[model samples]
Target: MDTPDTPHVNKERIDTMEHLSAAIGVSRPTLSRYFQDPDNVSRTSRERIRKGLERVEYVPNFFATRMNRKSTGMIGVIIPYLNDLFFSRLLEAIERAAMDVGYTVITQCSHSDPAIEARAAETLMSMNVEGALVAPLGNHSDLDVHERLRSRLPFVMVDSRPDTMPEVDFVGTNHYHSTGLATEYLARVGGPPVFLAMPRVNFNAMERERAYIAKMEQLGLEPRIVGVEGVSGAGYFEAHGQAVLEREFSSGRLVASSILCVNDRVAIGALRAAATHGLEAGAMQRGGLRIAGHDDYPLCPYTVPSLTTVAQNVDAIGRTAVARLVESIRAEKSSGKQILKLFDGEMKIRESA
Candidate 1:
């Protein structure tokens, strides 16, 4: 179905850019410019091109188009885990924000492997991406690859950061504020909560743990920490939470009636452990253990007693990361000074605490 506003007379043989441009009634240069960035062309011509492109069957050579332009109109985002809903939500928000400003996102999932993480960074660099956003693998990440990307492109870190890169741009939740909020809130309602720590997978684990310890000390309380600390070993997700809690229960070493888990995943596992131990999750008044977690996860509210944790400003995190990265990308040269944007994490009180 051809429209009257456009010059799309051909039903066949529109396989070349030149022919497509002719069919669309635009100059070759304008067509090329439009292909590079639709916003670069005037609205009228852009609409005409859009309408005509649908009629034609010409597929622009993606690599050829990128080779001709200095601006790729593309941003690369490398995430540590694609299966994790939190990262998935963050990625979704990043994509929407990038699209709002007329940019395409190229995503790579690292699968939580150091070699894979390094390779992902290298792949984006090889593609000549205008910029990159990474949710690093913390201690396990290859910093050299990120360093190389930082040298040539506008690079930003999301969620977590490795220790070596002190001057890189980062956008994430305020771990101190988040963990402290949960710790203090739990102490006030119940007794001082024993910290249930996650494996040292990334800087976030330590950040949250230290924040909890600091808050507990500030309250003049003993900070009892449980769970494995060596590395992100065997157990995944809830399994880690469940196993640690079960071990503490068996050992009869877990003190403090209330428990604060590292995150909602661990918290959920702890809840399961409580149920397994014939303990209920609710207020301490019902002879139940008060359990709280960090990062008011998507499933937190749906948990048996609903998890009481801190709410990270995921919207702000995602939007701010893209804005900061885009700003850096547009700069003639990136401002070398490290930029850190930490969004606040508010306490979300629920039945679990």
Candidate 2:
């Protein structure tokens, strides 16, 4: 994100569609239909509207238009954080899908605060959004707000969902499948691995941990989880991973030859901890400790020795969420089903494992 050094124009815009219709010799209904969807009008009308829009420097007043309509063609999205690469990619996918359906997206970031999340939901409601796609705060979230969102609009939870509100529609990664896939691969290629966990922050963390333990026990290996509980999952995961592994290393009790980190950030932290201890992380054939994680983060492949992880189907999640939400919006109701729409995670084998 950089500022544009060169400053340019002070152009005037035609605010109301009525004035634009008069200026462009197009009917007001044609202008409205065109703005809603260019295909809604005839080919000749679309061409005329396109050229007319350029001629008048037209900019539709979204707020004013929304005020006059029962359906605003807008969707609200609330996420936990913006700095995480996974979420950033997910947002782009959602934006593209919404655009394809001729809907605008209004996004809000809670910054890991439940109060902020509730406020974001309220703000979206006040904006008169037709539907919402939310990533709730899990145990820390305001269940009342989620209940209200579910009761009122076409709401679908994405990525993470609150434990209490199981009734809401959800779309996210299938943690059991992903964890089992990664754990089994590590067990076959190397040895049974110890799980390095994240804090008990959200549903994803808890689900991943549970899945890892289940997989380990299924393989007849003891499940060992190394993590600090009740800590914040706001940010700085690498620091958390490094601190935990460093302490384990110093005590001389870290005997595991293979480690499965919760996420790539924690695995990156593990790499730092290994470097400090003069240990190497790579494939087992090289006589190195094998380390792997989930969530093929954008920077994982660039890390030292690279990182083997699972890649979430971000596009599928976004597209499915929007499609279902739109269906609910048009139907004026939810499907009233609690079944979570889960997408599979793909295995990404790198030098690390």
Highest lDDT: which candidate? 1
Model 1 segments beyond 4 Å from truth?
A: 1-15, 18-30, 37-54, 59-63, 230-234, 253-256
lDDT (0 to 1) per candidate: 0.84, 0.84
* Candidate 1, poorest ten consecutive residues by summed lDDT: 228-237
Q: How do the residues 65-143 of candidate 1 rate in per-residue lDDT, one tens digit apiece?
A: 8868978788999998877888878998999999999788999988989899888888888888899999987787888
Over all chains combined, what TM-score does candidate 1 have? 0.88
Best by TM-score: 1
Query: How far off is model 2, as Cα RMSD?
Result: 4.8
In lDDT terms, how accurate is model 2?
A: 0.84
lDDT of 2 by residue, 299-324 (tens): 98998878999999999999999998
- What TM-score would every model get versus the actual structure? 0.88, 0.86
